[model samples]
Target: MSTLNLLRCAPHALKKQPVWVAPSRNIALSSFLRDAPAATASTKVLPGHEYYPGKEEYGTVIGNREIVGHGEIPYYSDSFMVPCPAIRFKEVDEELGKLREKEKGDWKLLTLEEKKTLYRASFNSTLEEVRAPSGDWKRCLGDNAILIGIMFFGLSVIGLSDPEFEPITVTNEWVDAQTEYLIKRRVQPVDGISSWYDYENNKFKPTWSIFTTKETSQSVKTLSERGV
Candidate 1:
């Protein structure tokens, strides 16, 4: 393969960019991949899209059947819009535990920096609590053993999802740039025209230049050139 093609085929092998964009929001691969097979047709992972029943449906089924219309309701239709896979929480947790144990030994060997860049857990913890404490578990280093262990657990699950992509080393510059981009708001107009002006007539027309400052111009140029 050509160099470009080879790189495209193995993008994760490239040198780290200055930012990381998580592929999915909140959904961990382990929650799906580690799950046990469905016990019934309702629970199966269907090929097309799926729907989750809203509170009203769930409440009607579990709370008051009388509130719903009088009829023999179908099992799947009554409780949820999607297939109600017959998996129990206990079974799912047990399966996840087994999967975690299978990978924990090796995941523990990865460096702290690698864990953060690779999207692995920074320590060990339940997935629900993985994002607690302001999602700043990395800051707990040397102080919070519980959070660190949870981060460790997250790493193993992420590692199991992709075998080839090792986490890249993160830099402070990368983190700063990513944060700035993440928090940037849509553009807005400045309220006033405050500029040093040269007099043409009695009128103080502004300078022809659009750039307000050297720093601002330089930053714009850097971002445009790098596509970061």
Candidate 2:
């Protein structure tokens, strides 16, 4: 039979003890919990599913490629990404069982309530219900706006109390010192400043580093002292 038909009819047979042909403990547990149920009066758990108290109710059972449910919570979501839920939201009780039998006939013949009843038995919510706005984003945006206001207020207080910031490295003295250091180290001499030097003028006439005679003499003296 098709998986859908099995899903529709399997619950009626779920009360019966499953044929325990599974090889491993893991398989046995999922299959037993999914396939069979405990006696209601005694609250008896099936053999393999009862690892501890109420462990059988953890999730649905799986056996013979069919899942049966017990004491599972109902849930429904309208999502485009996830197409299938692991199990039905509602279990098939006697009323739903009878309706399911009738569901085998022409769906068009079924009354609106009957059709709705059948659908509700399997799911807790519809696409329209899930898609409806809950006004949650308003609260979220309000909270974020309050946080932004607080951040701005704190930043204003800090800026008013704190001393003004200065970037010392951007001053003329610092730049001149850095330029002299670079000249002393003969930075990029082959492909740079020296490559376009006015040797006859005994001066650095390159466009970028217009070094005066005094600064150039100090850099050259530093380079000679450093043996480079």
Candidate 3:
């Protein structure tokens, strides 16, 4: 047999010898070597459409305006004028007139005895004799001296007898007169001008300004031009 025929037919030598083979590219080596999907048009960034920093980049943006911090901005209008009501001096005069008439009527209706009783009560006289004086002595001594004498008698008789006695009767008319007097004293007009005024023209402006000053300031003007 020839040499080539003899090598091909040699089974013992082929089984003992090592075989050398080239690696195939079609076989997968690892899981990382697998093909990835292609990116869509939406994932890609377009040219000249890059992000740019704005003026309010670091602050809060509201209606295209950036606010760094709260500033001193007044929410109210400076030129806004407040409404004031006019003073009605006529009404005050009428009320005062009515009070005066009532006081006169009450005074007229009050008897000499009632007046004397009120006088004694006002001075806080406690002596029963002075409170209800008898004989011509009360008529001659007058109310003032009688009240003084009663006070002196009360002080002298303190340890001898209890000075506590019945209180004098105060009428409803007296109480009403007293209350009206106090209210009138407080609410009476200062220089005859009862209402507030803003000197814009010849007309009188009515405001709720109750404060009155002897002299006018730059912001506040006097109610009366004639000093009432």
Candidate 4:
């Protein structure tokens, strides 16, 4: 195979990318590499892809995988922590068939290309590829920003559409009247803003009379006699 074709095969680190999006899966590979008896329609791999490279052979079915109709091969997924996926990505072609035979021997005997081919047959991407930082956050932020701006624009449109809906109570005259009414009622005479008023003098009193200033404590005593 060309060098490019060899590189097309993947690695475990690149295995991390979630681009290999898949859900839970199921597949039944018959243990012996013989023809499946015509009696049964092999249950499909739940992940939605072919596990066996060719139609003639099957591998031993692993786990609680239920075998159903003939279709939909298993796939790889980062979200799922399954150590072994239900099926391989591709079938056993001539080159891969040879690698599988050699794989049964010592690890040191296999070339780097053969090792990579085995890994790719099983996994879609390296772990790092699955866990790689995709800039999805930028898209989310942009979408939310647009949504907020739309909401703000809607609020501004409503506000501008009806000038009469604006609150009248925020005017200076209204505030002054509200303050006068509160003072007239002697509201909160105990340790509150209203307590600072001198009703007899018709004015607000200095709180310096309560707290000992740099001047003296007599100011406190004088203020204490005011029934404040």
Candidate 5:
């Protein structure tokens, strides 16, 4: 017979039997303690003081002093205090002096290209090597293969179907284009601000000016004087 027919034949077997009840015992003290009302906020007792219910307007007292709500007492101690080192400032100054001397020595060793690279790195230059890729494609493939193998093994153990994994493919031309784009972005001058070279300061200061008619006329006059 089918599962449904078997269940219908034993319908009384599925019905719940009557539960047994124990005899009740007298618990006058327990009932009184359980049903007793808790102390309200106004009638609450503070440490070292007892609150008098119904006389809450006057408040509690202890040893001639009227006890108000718990008062905060500021505490201070030097139990775990640490003593300052005698040569703290002197040691710090000596270390800073040594660092400055070392920096001066290192600055002399760095080439112009290395200095420029350092400056570019301080900015948004993500590439460690501008001309070539930093990581090996073989290593990346190996890592991906291991990850996929683990995933497939886990799915198989759990009785799941294996998913198709596609490999990432890139052309030499695409990589070169990306490298060129990065180089261009790294060396590109700030927009809306030209003539940044400050002859007086011997440094470039990125600045911009509004092209008003008055300023334009003044610039033209200056350019005419310079014979530009």
Candidate 6:
């Protein structure tokens, strides 16, 4: 199934697992954590004011923009320019240092199941459109909001204080690492869930890394190859 559906269903399947709320082992972050925004068919990106008129015929920026025409939508360019790696690395390093300090003493307090449930529920509620009413366990969580909330919760339980947006840097990297690690470790595991290690003060913090079953991964691969 799709990543969003898995997250929506996870809480019910794994109730009160401490790992869901607060994981104790290092896990990898999966695409499910990042797919919400992209998965919503209702979502759309309006063209930015910085349109490239010169490259209109180049099939680059054109794919990037979405224009409505003749009762249809057209995609322009796909190439998105990010900052230079050197600058990115420096910024990431600075952020990581602060996160290390902010997350100090936070480690493996909650079980992996609890962390997962909380993470999944919070993520759905915060990020995606909430199908269930407020206070429902199955609402979607926002990527940045939920990450910060969970990170803050984890850190606060251990007597640490977060400033703001600190978790994004840490969570994004952790998620990427987790996804890569899982894809490497398991041959086509499930698609939506993710795993990762929580760290603080240069030490690997105890946290549960969520993972998809190998069987599910194989099924996903089979379906994907068949374009199902």
Residue lDDT tens for model 2, 1-228 = 655445343433443564333223355656666644432333444533342323445335321121333323323333433223334556667777788778767767889898778666655555455568879999999999999999999988888887584468855456556655665566767765454344555445445344435655555444434443
Question: Candidate 4 vs candidate 6: which has greater lDDT?
Answer: 4
lDDT of 3 by residue, 72-171 (tens): 2211111113011111111224544444344345566756764444333222222333336357776777977889999998877874576564334344
- lDDT for residue 112 in candidate 5, whole number 0-100: 71
Which segments of model 4 are wrong by more than 4 Å? 1-75, 91-98, 165-228
Give the Å shift of residue 154 in candidate 5.
2.4
Q: Candidate 1: lDDT over CA atoms?
A: 0.36
Better of 2 and 6 by TM-score: 2
| Tens digits of lDDT, candidate 6, 43-79 | 3323221222233453353343222211112232111
Query: Could you give candidate 4's per-residue lDDT for residues 79-119 as a string of tens digits?
Result: 33544454455665677667766766787897887787787
lDDT of 5 by residue, 70-184 (tens): 2222111111121111111111245444443443454667567644443332222222233356478889999999999999988786664435543232443454344334333
TM-score of each: 0.14, 0.36, 0.11, 0.35, 0.16, 0.14
Output candidate 6 Cα RMSD.
35.1
Q: What is the C-alpha lDDT of each candidate?
A: 0.36, 0.52, 0.33, 0.52, 0.35, 0.35
Off by over 4 Å in 2: 1-77, 91-111, 129-139, 163-228
Q: What local lDDT does model 1 show for residue 81?
A: 25
Q: Which stretches of candidate 1 lie over 4 Å from their true place?
A: 1-144, 163-228
Candidate with better TM-score, 1 vs 5: 5
